[model samples]
Target: MLFRQLEYLVALARERHFARAAQACRVSQPALSEALRKLEDELGVLLVRRGRAYEGLTPEGERIVRWAQRILADRDALRDEVDALRTGLSGRLRIGSVPTASGAVPLLTGPFCTAHPLAAVELSTDLRADELLRQVRDFEINAGLSYLPEQGTEGVRTVPLYEERYVLLTGPADGLAGQPHATWTEASRLPLCLLHPGMQGRRVLDGVFAGLGLAPAPRVETDSVGSLFAHVRTGHWASVVPYAWLHVFGVPPGMRAVPLVEPVHSTPIGLVTAAREPGSVMARALREVARRTDLAGVLGALPKA
Candidate 1:
């Protein structure tokens, strides 16, 4: 019946614990429970499967949760619109990005902030491509920086940004050193540190290796790019990573990067948002920023590794 009640219910469903949910809502446990009970009474349906402990929501509650998400999103969109009109656009722009594209997001957000100084931005890089698409569609994130899904995705809009190419990172004494470029086959034979297979970058690299009929067994696998760099700094390990990352992270003191060849493959990365009409003002602003971003110029400014 009320926005606060809906917020309480949504928070409870997400946390799945009465005490924790209450903590999240910044209210007492008893107050949150009473609010949910009141919401159920007003709606004339049993929403939660109540017990001594926290139980899951009922089927109808699940439906209501979906509606609550949309309603809350619309409410925020309205607020953003009014705020933009009153002064200037000012709200948090939540962005989900895949690990590989994480470095390049600043290229878009930098100019965006200069244009709309009042706006706030939050970027999360741990999400995979599929998670980014799902979150964008579910209104969990305003937009995402990810590769276009191979089979294509539904209920989403995409703004093409740039192609993601890869390079091999190694120390001067490494096996592949002194080469202008290294092939997948050539790189696979070395002691490599790579992202986990669950990550989009790793999957793409796996696909390339599979296509080449090669299997690369990495000496070290991790989720952090920083870790990969750290290991490669030992002068005994190497990694194959995005070309943009080489420019973004800057080749470490002892490390050098060489382009990947023997068939250079590039994947397209872009800004993805929900396809729903009347998108949030922040989402629209990001799309406009993406349109005006001179990706080539930005890339050219970085020292080539």
Candidate 2:
């Protein structure tokens, strides 16, 4: 019934352990347990499955917890709205982005911060596309930067930000360096260093090669861009990265970044927010920033190899 009780319940559902959930809620174990029991009594349903340890939520508990999430999100939205009316926009804006889109997030965050100096932004750039969307839908994050889902974007609003283009980065002495452009076929022949298979960017690059009846044999594979860049710095490794990355991290010394052409490819990356009635004010603010940002133009203006 109380918002505090709902908060505890949602934390419990997320943590799946009583003590950890209580820790997240900043309350004692007994306090969290008593609150949930009271919530169950008021709702007339057994909300948790208990057996000396935190087992899991019951069937009805599962459904109720979803509603609890909604209720809490709506409550936060109301508070943010009222706060904005009084003291301007002020709150933490949480955004989750797929690792490949890491460079592009600054386009939105930079403007958002300047526009609303009172607001705080928390960015998580290590999430995969699937995990990013899930957090957006759950209200665990205010918004997400990722590719549009193929099947359906049922529970979120999509705001297309930019078209993500690929570019081949190589050292000066590398095989394809100084070239105006490199095809997927040509790039695959080098001692490549690419993102690991689990990343969306890797999957996309693999699909492109698979269509050509070729599979890239990477000499080095990594999940971190820093590591990939380090390998490319050796002049013996080449990697394909998104063009937007050049906007944030310019071509390092002794390196070149050429557009990947010969049947050019681009992925549509966008901002996703929960499709709820009273959405988070922070999300709405970010959407406004996205509309005003000339992301495509900014990324396209980067110097070409």
In lDDT terms, which candidate is top?
2
CA lDDT scores, all candidates in order: 0.87, 0.89
What's the C-alpha lDDT at position 140 in model 2? 96
Tens-digit lDDT track of model 2 for 1-305:
49999999999999999999999999999999999999999999999999989999999999999999999899999999999999999989999999888888988898999999999999899998888888888889999999877766889999888888888999888657777788989998988999999988889889888988889899888988767778888887999998888877788888898889876998888899999876999999999999999887887665643
Using TM-score as the measure, the top candidate is 2
Residues 1-305 of candidate 1 have per-residue lDDT tens digits of 49999898888887899999999999999999999999999999999998889889999999998788778878888999999999999989999999888888999899899999999999998888888887887788899999988666787899988888888888898767788778889998889999998988899999999999999899889998778889989888989988777667787688888888978998999899888779788999999999999775565342554
TM-score of candidate 1 on Cα atoms, chains taken together: 0.94
Model 1 stretches with alpha carbons more than 4 Å out: 300-302
Q: Please, what is the TM-score per model?
A: 0.94, 0.95
Q: What's model 1's lDDT at 66?
A: 78
